[model samples]
Target: MSGAAPMRVLANATELIELLAGEGALPLVDVATRIGVPRPSIYRLCEGLAAVGMVELLPDSRVRLSTRWLALADAARAGMLEWRGAPEVLAHLVERTGQTAYLSVPYGSSALCVDWCQGRAIDVLAYRPGSMMPLHVGAAGRTFAAYGVPLPEGDRRRRTEKTIIDYDELAADRERIRRDGYALSEEDVTIGIGAVGVPILAPDGTLRGALSLGGLVEDIRKHCDEFVAELRAGVERLSGV
Candidate 1:
């Protein structure tokens, strides 16, 4: 097979996995339709995934991810060496602030949430494990920009009325976050939700990831300073500093 053939198959396989992960079991025809692959190709892809133990072919000709993914997920978390101390830090932040805490690392022009601890007060469902937030919005995304990760080009996505999409405004926000050592967002991603984020820096000062607290807009805005302090403390603990 030519190199392109394998790359195409790999891309299709990845898309198939993400589709099943999001939508649960579905008929092979529907999977093909949703993924824009041919029906025959979709079936082959499903068979390949099942053979690899990544997914299961249901009795009704539908398919779903296999239980092996649970083990894989656990293994992935454990394998992320930089985030070795993340779970304890996330738990402590949630306990300290009573808000959802997330650990995200830069992935291309987006922030990929690797782990999170749900808050006691409310669930801010905008970000979760495996979810991606773009670099120009959200506290975690902006923290990457603040730490010198360049933003993706093109008009910024307008997720909410309060989302800052203008390049000049985003430049200012990045500068402020750089100066303050944290980023704060108020209803930028989801209405009525707010967040505070701080970059997790290595001892040599490279960006490791971002730690964030998210909750109700008013609550987050009201306690922004305190949240920044708590998140920084968590980063300190994670870094053993």
Candidate 2:
């Protein structure tokens, strides 16, 4: 809308990607026709992206995702530290809590899961790597809120019956977590699933991400304190890294 050039550029880039995903590469004219933009604009977009290593422009006047993207993907994969004992820790967390365990880091305005493990008794496992949940509807979000992540006003809406809709109420909850060093969520994202979330603090005391355990509400309530202790220990152990 309006003259938001950056937004328009981003939209054109995503549309071009979707087209290329299904149709491979095409010249500026075909790409502009499919995306309903001017050919000159598409050409400029492609050139800009190609300069930044996002696309490769061929002598045949076609374009495709650059081979360099593989290095970027590898870097992102390494960023998760999945190869460096994270999965084992999550598996152990599941065993100790008898609930699904998650490691969610803040990505933009959402909690982005990088790893998880399903517990033995868990019949429902919903989260996985690349899954993103908004910053207002889960234990991970509550952890971000407690640490002053600055969620937008729109995310304060209802996603479930137990989702906190009022900013004042959510503020009080965040305040409690900031004081208590953890957050508990009950039936906020999915009904009947309760969770406890704790922050894995960095050496500088910055919030890295959240580690959470989720399962049936009854079981979660029965072992919440133990789960909290275990989660805190996990954070402390990670902090030594």
lDDT of 2 by residue, 41-127 (tens): 989999999999888899998988777755765577577653355676788888777788888888767787777788888667455
Which pairs clash in the backbone of model 1? none
Q: Quantify all predictions' global Cα lDDT against the true fold.
A: 0.88, 0.79
lDDT tens readout by residue for model 1, 65-158:
8989878878888898878888889999999999999999998777888999999988646788876788988999999988988898874779
Compare the candidates by TM-score and give the number of the best one.
Answer: 1
TM-scores for all candidates: the values are 0.80, 0.70
Off by over 4 Å in 2: 1-7, 11-75, 81-83
Candidate 2, residue 211: lDDT? 89
List of clashing residue pairs for candidate 2: none
